[model samples]
Target chain A: MNKVMLLVDDDDSLSKFIKICVEESGALMEVKQVTSVDKAMDYLQNKGEFADKSRNPDPYVMLLDLGLPKTSGIDFLKRLKNKKEYAGMPVVILTAMESTENIRNAYCNYANSCLIKPFGFEKTKELMKSVTTYWGRYNRLPDRAD
Target chain B: MDKDNPLVLLVEDNDGHAQLVALGMRDSGIDHELIRVSDGTQALEFLHKKGKYESSQQPRPGLILLDLRLPKMDGLEVLKEVKSDELLKDIPVVVLTTSEAEKDIAKAYEFHANSYLVKPMHFDELSSMLQETGFYWLACNKRAY
Candidate 1:
């Protein structure tokens, strides 16, 4: 079965690029894109429009962007990690900021991994390939009840 | 060396498994230096720079590949201690073990392990997994320190 990935990022172009790269990587993964942390939470909880389990399956991994409108990615990470139900979820932070403090904060908040948003087409493609191959294909997740 | 090529500390008691991991990393062609410790106690000692490691000049490892079962101490105990330590918590600790029990997976994540990966039974699959693991953590994943 193809694994579901929740991508929370406001950047339309980058999100589209990542979606394309991940799909093209041949990893069995379906990327669900959301612009805000609230939308991501909704998706995860199967609330509102995401009520259809078939359409919105539980994501095995989440690619979180540090920058968001109100609830920042770091803040979202803290919230998610605080929930024991979301303990097994792997949240990988994708950000353009190379700030040491931001990176430290993300990991300190229990982010599974952090990767700089790559520049240009080739680098992004390579990154997506590695991301999908590693997280989607190889990394194992705890069993989640449907 | 450089941030892109950080040292990897592998904590495993099995000699054969450790050798396979080294070979797999070599096959991946990613520049890395792997230091091995046989048990969970030594793993913590190396991380905290305790006892024999007190005078060691090795820089803080960028990644830690931990095994669940070990002599002296268990992997989960080591994981809990590392994640609890402010200085060590930031480092990515990926649990690499043979057990795929649901309890183990859930527990590792509960301890805030960076990731959990089951060691493949076949030699070829193990090699492939190590390559992907090494490539992703060492090359693709960015570190703060």
Candidate 2:
């Protein structure tokens, strides 16, 4: 099975970079991108344009950016985790904010893991490779019943 | 301990598994100190600094590798307590177990486990998994503290 990763970030360039890196990392995984928290919710719930479950499979893991235009990523994380249906989904915080407070907030809101967005292209690639290799190959997600 | 090389608290009842973890960490070459507790009660005591762990100079762990089937108390119970505690909630807790049952996986995640990894039957695979786990959690994942 091709493991799908849901990437929720507003930065188009960064998201694209991550998608390329993940694909190049040779981990049999797919990156599905969404620009905002609302879009992410829609994608997860298979609402609106993502109504086809076959085309839009549930992601094994979600990489959420804390900064968003409308609904903040932290708020979305809290909402997603609070729901029993989405509670088991792993949500990894991929953000540029390294503040202890922000990291604490992410964890307090039940983020599965938190990673700081590394600087430089080489560093980012290395980080993404590790992220993909670990989350894609090693981590186990709960079975999603259709 | 510094963030680069933080203490790792390992809660596993099986001595063989604990030794394998030690070997795996050594093989991974990640600089970390592994503190092993045979039961869930001891694990909590170490984390909470109660009983024999009080006044000890060991630094707080940056990561916890928990086994679900633990003696004295269940690993899920320990995870719930740790994650619910304000002081300990931020520390990453990865569920390392042999069981691949869907219910256990769901319950561990529901309790806010940082990650869930099943132990492979093959020795080499287990070691490799441990190596990957150590590198990812200790070196890759950013610490809150």
Candidate 3:
């Protein structure tokens, strides 16, 4: 079976760019993009449009942006980590913010890993490749069943 | 030898695979010490300083390359124990194994393994994967502890 990825971000263009890049690389079987933390939660919870598990299987990895609309990424990270059911889900922080405070906060909130999002196309490609290769091929993800 | 560089503990039963990993780390451009253990029991002994390793002066490994299949105490058990421990939980445990089974992957992550890597089929790919891993974990990643 093909691996799945869930990308949570507010930027449509950025999400689109990543979708295109990741799809082109063929690293993930499917890349599900959601614009807000609420939508992401809904999808994960199998509500609304994402109620269909066959179409939207639980992602093996999640790329979460720190900056979001209603619920901030850090807040989302904390919530995800606190939940008993989602404890095993690996959440990698992918964002433009590179400050020490942000890094410390993300890790403190129990984010699995934190990476700075690259700006340039080539750099973005490299980052995406690394992200997929590291998470999909290398990192062992927790089973959604548990 | 860079004395100040963070140490890595590699646990693998296959001699050939362990040597390849050694070679990869040696040429990885990131200079650091890599300690090798042949089985899961030795890994625990080295970590807990039990038996012959009671007086061993080796420092706590900043990174651990653990194999799932072993002679005694499978990798999952080791991971569960390590992650549950107060002192050892902070250290990153990267599962390096040949199995790509979903169950294994799920179990490892559930046990809170820091990362997981499957051995590459080709020599060059293995070396490259090791290079990327070394650079990412050792050079870039910020350790919690």
Q: Name model 2 segments beyond 4 Å from true.
A: B1-3
Which ranges in model 1 have alpha carbons more than 4 Å from their true place? Answer: B1-3
Where is model 3 more than 4 Å wrong at Cα? A1-3, A20-31, A52-54, A81-88, A96-110, A140-146, B1-6, B25-31, B39-62, B70-73, B99-103, B120-132, B135-142
TM-score of predicted chain B, candidate 2: 0.96
* Tens-digit per-residue lDDT, A1-146, candidate 1: 57888999999999898888887777788888999998998999899989888889888889999989999999999999999899888999999887999999999999999999988778888888888888888888899776
| DockQ per model, Cα | 0.72, 0.66, 0.26
Q: How does model 1 fare in lDDT?
A: 0.90
Q: Give the candidate number with the greatest DockQ.
A: 1
lDDT of 3 by residue, A1-146 (tens): 57778999988898888887887776755678898999999989989998988878778789899999988999999899777678667788888887767876776566777777767666666667767777777665554562
Q: Is candidate 2 or candidate 3 better by TM-score?
A: 2
lDDT, candidate 2, A44-90, per-residue tens: 98999999988788998899999998899999999998999987788
State how far residue B14 of model 1 sits from its true place (Å): 0.8
By the TM-score metric, which is better: model 1 or model 3? Answer: 1
Candidate 1 lDDT, tens digit per residue, B1-145? 1236688999999999999988998787788889999999999999989989999999999999999999999999999999999998999999999999999999999999999999899999999988888888888888878
Model 1's chain B yields a TM-score of 0.96
> Which interface RMSD does candidate 2 score?
2.3
